[model samples]
Each structure stands twice: as structure tokens, then as C-alpha cells.
Target: MSNVVAAAENSYLAAFDQPGRATVEPTPRPGWRQAARDRFAELGFPTKRDEDWRFTNVGPVARTEYELAVAPAAVTLDQLEPWIYPEMARAVFVDGHFVAGLSDLDGLPDGVRVGSLAAALEGGDVTAHDHLGRYAPFDRQAFIALNTALFADGAFVAVPAKTVVERPIQLLFVAGPGERRMAFPRNLIVAGEAAQVTLVESYVGLGTESLTCPVTELAADPAAVVDHYRLQQERTDATHIALQHYHCERAANVSTHSLSFGGGLVRNDVWAVLDGEGVECTLNGLYLTRGRQHVDNHMWVEHVKPNCNSYELYKGILEEQSRAVFNGLIHVHPEAQKTDAKQTNRNLLLSSDAGVHTNPQLVIHADDVRCTHGSTVGQLDADAVFYLRSRGIGEEAAKSLLIYAFARDIVDRIRLESVRTDLEEFLFSRLPKGEIVRQAV
Candidate 1:
């Protein structure tokens, strides 16, 4: 066994009373982490024995060597001249620890708190802690337990009742240069009754061989609306594993948009639960990979109450010898009658060497539920490409145009226009360097 796995099992067993593993410091948890860690040790990493992970492999993730990252180098705003966003409240974290001086949180409204998890906990913001690990049962998932055991820093936002935050809270997580460096970021967003907010979490890297394991949990109370977007663009040799868990209450509306473009090996796991009546949710994702890179996105949407609606659509583009995987599951419980849920996944392969595996599953224990799922994987339409070429378009230009049109369908579904434009620009710039990105969309 690798040292990291050995340390994970033995270190926690040794310090059962102290709570949590050692990271930047000994920030004790409120008793939940200890129980969860013990369970993780007994269960170990999930294998094909676990139905949920039957098709996915954790052997590589389990044996990888990862260490907690240290304090980043002194990179100030003046030195960060290339990073800029439009009129957004921003917070910066380096090596998984909040750097207040490096952050720009100006123009934020009153009654809204945007800070780090460590700082918030030290300041006695205990109300938000109640729902931290409540959504997903960490006892069954090793990664969740590992994150709870080693989490050091991440963005924390809490909106009060009946308040609307006009500006979006932008979070940037930077992984500094170091060998075997690992960072764990935990983000918690809670929107109170009738509250409205938007949150964006962006992950980037300064080094090539780093590991970033992140977990984000969002909670929306009754009649609340929340828009969450996660953008991952890391170094080529880095490995990223991220999980986003969201819970919605009665009449709550939640929209999640994900863009995965970088990293040597990246996997994004999103789970959203609608527990209250009349709750509505929309989950959209886009992934682009080339070379030998590997990208996977797994999503689960559960409806536990009646009269709820949900929609899911994920698009992917793979090139070279890269591989992509998409697994989507929608479940409707017996009490969740009148549930309307639709799910679909589409993939475009630019080269014969590229590979894509997509599957959409539905489990319904309710009779009156309206649920459907479908998946498609194929190359560019030759008819469309020929038509474009006949209309005076060059061969390369025609192929690119057809490919871009396939991806544009999902891009147009993005509610934020600026984010959509930025994503398009980033993809466009990368396409010239890769066979897949060069495609029109």
C-alpha cells in the first residue's frame, strides 16, 4: 500500500479523540469528522464491489501520493496583473488557505458575509456549520471522508433572509508550485428564506505536478434561488477530483453550470437533492479534452417530494487518444409523484482515436412521474459538413463549423451571458492547439 493510504487509515485510527487529520493546523471539528473517518477506515476506498462505483475505478486515486500544500509564494495583486474579472466580488486562496490581503471583496452589499471557512469558524459563525456535511453521507464515500479529515480552507458565503446580493461572489483557488503538494478546499454556501445569490468557484494551478481535492456544499432554504458555477482549468500534469452537493427546500430554484477544460486527469461529481415540494433544478455541464487527458463527470438528481421538476444536459468533445465518461442518474421516490425530469448526454469525437462512454439511467418508484433519459455518441455529421463546404466554406472550416454547432446548443443554455462568452473564448483559444478544440463550437 502507498504511504498516503496507510497514513489515512492509521493516522485517523490513532487520533480518534482529537478529531480530524493534521493539515496546516489542528482545527478540530464538532465531532462529525471523527465518526466519519472511523467509518472510512473500515470501509476503505470504494471498489467495484460498491454498485455506485462499479464502472469507475478508484485504485489509481487511492494509491496516488498527495501531501498537504504549504503557504504559497508572495504573489500580490500587482504581480497578478493578468487576472481580472468584471465588477465581481473576489476572494483569493493560495495553497488551500485564505489570503485576505490578496483578495478583493469590495462593493459587496451589507448583511452578506464572504470569507474563509477557517476565519468564519474562528469567528463563531457556527450557524452555517450545522448543514456542512448533512447533505451527503460521508460515511459511505471515502473521498468525502478524506476531505472532512484534511480540509484546510475554502470560500464560505451566507446570505440573510429576504436579501438579494446583486454582485456575484467569485472565488479563485490557486495551487502553488511544489512536488507532491495536495490541497483540499471546502466551500459552504447557505441561502436563507427568500434570499437570492450567485456563486462562482474557479480553480487554477501554478505548478504542473500538484493534486487538488475539493468539496463544495450548497443549501437553499424555502423560496430561495441560487446559481452556482464551477470552472476548472489546471496545469497539464495535475490531478483534480471535485464533488458538489446541493440541497433545495420547498419552492427553491437551483441552477448549476460546470465547465471542465484542463488537468491531466479530472473527475467532477455533482449530486443534487430536491426534498421539498415544488422545488426546481437545472444541471448543465460541458467538458473538452485532448491528447492523453481523461475527464469524467457523474451526476445524480433525486426528487423526494411531489410536484417537482428537473432538467439535465451535458455536452462533451474529445480528441486525440483522450477518453471521456458521463454517467447521469435520476431517481423519483414514491412520494415524488408528478415529478417531471429529463436527462441527456451528447458527445462529439473529432478523431477516430478519441473515445467516449455515456450512459443515462432512470429509477422511478413512483407511478405518476414523467422521467426520460437518452445518450448519443458519434462523429461530425458528414452531410452537414458537405453542405457547409458546398456553400463556399473550406474543408477545414466546414468541419469546424459543424462541430461548433453541436456544442453551441449547450452553451446557449447558460443563463449568464458573460460567463458564456468567456468560456467560448477560452475554448476557442485552446482549439487552435488541439484537434478537438479547433472545431467550430
Candidate 2:
């Protein structure tokens, strides 16, 4: 076996070798972890030769040997104040383990439950047992297999039938000051029949050199409406790989938004399945990169029944020597007649050294389906920049204003006002002479 395999396997055994660690935080499921462990041993890691990973390389991740944190890192509430929203329920995870002390769920309405996934399993909650490993199978991806086998804790949320949550629930994962350790965060969200809720999965860490792999699975029952967001705000030196799996039942309406700002090497995988007729699914994303950062997004939407609808739009902004990739597919099954699916990917490059690879595809087995996909890559419009410059704006500020105008198309789609407002401020602070842009808003 390669060093990567040997090092990762040793960490796994070490987790079990420590007395009380296993008993303190048992696997989410008993047999599933072993199954995933076996899979990881067999598949190891994916190379660039793999079709899905043709342009993205994991060699840096594979070659490095990272230690796992033995306990939760000490994190203060003051350190978490920036990410927490007022009057919103939140589940907090520090150093890959859920911390009830840092989380708040006091005002959650009836039929809504939120807590640690490990706690739910230890308590023998039937819902957690029935749905934990049902959607995100680890057979295809080694990182996913690693997460399944080693994730000690994460968030668990359940909203029962016909219930409507007034505010979005936050699943915040923070990495505190510690050794350069690896972290796996696993989350599960289940919405019952006709229930409505919004979920935000935020990953934030600063000045830490580590590898973090997270997996989130969402199950939307028939006629359910769920708005979900996956936000990545890691340090520029961190490595982050994340996966999202969504399953929608008949007449269910689901929307997902992805916002990425940091990380040295990042990969995001999103797979959504419309399992019943009359389902509506929408996916939107925006990513920003500078310096030597690398970001990749892989998206797949499957239409299994007739009369289902899905739309996807992803936009990216790259500067300096940054690189990115967007690979998306819309699949219409044979029985999915009258399916309507649309996909689009757009990118703006701010420097000559920056580049991107975009591929949007449609595979239709049904002749009656309506499926379309397109992708584009370009630089900031010279004339538009000139127009702004002629209006007394500095050269740098003019460029920043135009970039903000281009990115807001995706940010404006967010339904949560708090998140949208915060993101706007973050952008302004990052831009050159951003005060001018903020006033323009």
C-alpha cells in the first residue's frame, strides 16, 4: 500500500486504540463504519486519470500524513460570535466533534429536533438509524469512505410533517488553534412530508494548515420545501473537500446554494435525485479565488420520474494564478418523460495567469424531456470597466465594482436576508477601495 493508505489506516486504528474514545463516541452505525473502512482499503485514493477527477489532483492531500485530533479543541464563544445569527437555532462542532455548550436550540418549534448525530444514535433514535447511511454511499469516493469510517460527530436535524421553521438552522463547524490534524464532518438533515425548513452548513477556520472532508445528506419527503446552503470559509492554506447528497420525493421543492471563499485546494461534489413526479429542484453557487488557490465543483442532477424540473447555475471569479473547474451533468432517466432541466456555468477571470475548465452536459434517455446546458469563460468587460472609470472611479475601484455587479446575480438569489447581507459586507471588505463599492450599494 502507498504511504497515504498506511498513514490514514494507522490513524483509524489509533482512534480505537485509545481507551474510552470508542465508548465515548461510537460510530453512527455499528456495521456501516467497517463496511466503509473496507471500501477505503480497497479503493485507496483517486488519481487524476479518473474521468471525474481529470483536472483536479489529490496528490498533495495523499502524500501528506496528517494526525487526527484526540479531543475537541477549546473554542470560545467570542471566536464564534461572527458566524452565529441572532434568534436562529444552531448546532456547533469544534475540531470535528459536536459541542452542546457552544450550540443553541432553545426556541426551536415543536416537531423540530437538532443535536449531535452521535447523541441521536446513542439514544437509539429510529429516524437517525433508518436514514444515516441510506443516501450517501461511500463506494465511489475514497474521501467519502474515509469520512464515513472516522467521523466521530456532526449535526443531526429533523423537521416533522407540515411544520414550518421560521428561521434557518445553522450547522457551524469551526477549527480552533491546534496541531495540523485532519477533520471529517458528517451531517444529516431529514424533512418530513410537507415540512418546510432552511439549513446552512458553514465551515470556517483561520490560519490552520489541515485537511477537512465533510459530507452532508438531505432527505426531503413528499411535498416538502427545503432551502439549503453550503458555505466554505476556510483559511487560504487549508485543504477542504466536501460532498452533498440530496433526495427529493414527489412534489417536493428543494433549493441549494454554495458559496466558497477560501482554502488552498478545495473540491465540492453535489448530487441530487428527484425520485418522484412533479419535483422541483434548483442549484446555485458562487466562488471566489485568488493567489494560488484551486477550487473544483462537480454537480449531478438525476430525474427519475416524469414531469420533474431542475435548474443549475454556477459562477466563479478568479484572480492571480488561481485555477478552477466546474463539471455538471443533468441526467433524465427513461421513465422521466416531460422532464425539464436547465444548467449553466459562467466564470470571470481577472488575470491572464488565471484559468478555468467548465463542462456542462445533458444525458437524456427520454425523447420527450427538455434538457439544455451551456458554459462560458471570460474576463471583465473592458468597456464596462472604462465606463465606470470615466464616471470618476479609480481603476482598481472600478474593477471591484464591476466584479461585485457580476457576482451579485448569484448572491441575490439567497432567500435568507441575514446571510445575504453578511456576504455582501464580506465582499466589500475584500475588494480594493471597497468603501466605494459599499457606497454604490
Candidate 3:
């Protein structure tokens, strides 16, 4: 084994040995923790040799020795007020532990359960035991394994059958005052038959340098509708790795939107399986990177039944020596018929040193399937810039306008008004001379 791999293995073993690092009770799935650890030990971390991980390396994560974040830190709502949405129900976690004082769940609808995973388990919520680690299989992925083995706390959301939740549920995770530390967060969401719900998962970091690994599993029953949004806006010096697994049953509708704006090294893995007929799935993402940052997004969609539809669109903006990677795969099984799938990736580079790698693949074993994919990587249109400049717009402002226009395509698709407005404000602030545009708004 390589030295980096060995060092990583040692760190994992040491962390596992620490007291109270793993939270597993005897009543609820006793052997799962051990099974996950064994799986991680067998598979180890992914290297550059792996085709799926060829562009992104895990050496930095593996070699770094980070202590577990266990202590509870004080964080007021004022510190998080800017990011909080007043229209949504909130559940907060700080440094891997749920903080009741910082959370608000007033006026929540009936037939819905929202709280911390640890509390749910202790309260004997059977649904948590039934679907905690089912969708996100840990055997094939090392990061998932690590999360399963060491997860301290996360969010749990369940919508009962035939219920409609009009308001969105927000899961906020904050990392505060811990340097060289790591936290594992796991979430499970289940939408029953004919149920409708929306979820927003946000990760914010206030610490200097830390690492966060989070895994979320979503299951939608027949005729159910589930909308999920993940927003990652951590400290520029922090590292983030996240995984999401979605299962759509017959005639179910599921949509996921991911917006990534901050982090030093970030990787996101999303997988969806359409297991029943007439299902609809939508995946959309936008990522912005600058100042030597690295972001990677990997997605896979599997069509297991007939008459299913899937659509994917991902956009990226890179500047100032930043780098990004996008890898997407659409697979149609032999038994599946009339599967309609479309995938597209578009990227904009602002600086000469900025770089992007995009790959979209389609594998079809069914004769009656329509699958298409495309990818593009380029700089801004000089003609458009010139046209704006000729109209008395400053050069920098012209570039900013073009960049915002390029991003507006993805932003307009967001259904939630509050989320859309927040993202617009955040994106505008990151642009060059963006304060001028903000003033006009």
C-alpha cells in the first residue's frame, strides 16, 4: 500500500478507538457500525487509479489527522439569521451535536416528524432503524463507509402517507471554533405514498480549518413528491465531502438542486434509482469556485423500470486558478422500456488559469430508450462583452452582467422564492464590483 493510504488507515483506526466516537445502541441495529467499519477497512480510500475518481484525489483527506468535534459550542441565531428562512421549519446541529436552543419548529404541519437522528433513535423511532443506511450503500464507497462508521448526529425527516407539507423543512449544520477537526453528519428522509414535502440541507462553517463528511438518504413512495435542496457555503479553508442517495417508487416525482459556493476541497456524489414505472426525476446543480479552490460533482441515474423520465443540468463558474470536475452517468437496464433521459453540463472560465473537466456518459441496454448527453467548457463571449461596453457599460460591470446572465438559467428553475432570492443575493455579492449591482437592486 502507498504511504498515504497507510497513514489514512492508521488515522481511521485511531479515531475509531476514541471513546464516544461512534454512536450505536444495542437495541437498534447492533452490528451495522461494525459492518460499516469492516467494509471501510476492506475498501480503503479511492485513489487516482480508479476511473470514477481519476480527476479528484483523496490524498489530502486521508493524510490529514483531524480530531473529532464533540464539544458543543455557543452560536446565536443572530449569527445565522442571514441564512435562515423565516418561512421554513428549522433544525440545527452544531459541531456534530443537535442544539435544541438554536432550533425552531413552530407551526409545523401534522403527520410530519423532524428532529435530530440521535434523539429519534433514542426515542425508538422504528423508521429510523428501518431506513437509516439502506439507500447509501457503504460497501462500494469509502466516504460513505466512514460516515456510517462514525456518524455522531444529523437530521431525520419523515412525512406520513397522504399528507401535504406546504412549508419547507430546513436542516442547518454549523461548524464553529474548531480547527483541524472533523464531523460526520447523516440524514434520512422518507416520503410516504401520496405525500408531498420539501427539504433544504445547508452547511455553514465559522471555524478556521475543518472537515465535514455528510450522507443523506431519500426514499419516495408511490405517487409521492419530494423536493430536496443542498446548499454548501462553508469557510474558504474548510474541506467538505457529501453523498446523497435517492429512491423513487412508482409514479413518484423527485427533484434535487445543489448550489456550492465555498470550500477549499469539495466533492459531492449523488445517485438516484427509479425502481417503478412512470417515475420522474430531476437533478440540477450550480457551483462557483475561485482562488485555488477545487470542486467535484459526480452523479449517476439508473432506470430500472419502464416509462420513466430523468433530466439533469449542471453549470459551473471558475476564476483565478480554480479547478472543477463534473462526471455524470445515465444507465438504462435491459428490462426498462421507454426511458427518457437527458443530461447536459456547461462551464464558464473567467481567468486564463482556470480549468474544468467535464464528462457525461450514457449506457443503454434497452432497445426502446431515448438517452442523450452533452458537455461544454469555454470562456465568456467577447462579442457580448463588446456589445455591452459599446452601450456605455463599464468593462468590469459588463463582464459581471454576462456572468450573472449565464448563471440565471439555473437560478430561474428554483421553485422556492426565498431560496431563489437568497441565492441571487449571494451570487451577486461574489461577482466583480458586485456591490454596484446590489445597490441598484
Best by lDDT: 3
TM-score of each: 0.90, 0.94, 0.96
- Model 1 alpha-carbon drift over 4 Å, by segment: 1-29, 48-50, 54-56, 70-73, 78-84, 432-441
Residue 192, candidate 3: C-alpha displacement in angstroms: 0.9
Extract clashing residue pairs from model 2. Answer: none
Q: What lDDT would candidate 2 get against the real structure?
A: 0.86
Ranking by lDDT: 3, 2, 1
Can you list the residue pairs that collide in candidate 1?
Answer: 400-440, 404-440, 404-441, 431-437
Which wins on TM-score, candidate 2 or candidate 3?
Answer: 3
Weakest 10 consecutive residues, lDDT, candidate 1? 19-28
lDDT of 3 by residue, 234-273 (tens): 8889899889999999999999999999888899999999
Provide backbone clash counts, one per model: 4, 0, 0
Each prediction's RMSD to truth: 3.6, 2.2, 1.8
Model 2 / residue 385 / CA error / Å: 1.9
Alpha carbon deviation, residue 70, candidate 1 (Å)? 5.1
TM-score of 2: 0.94
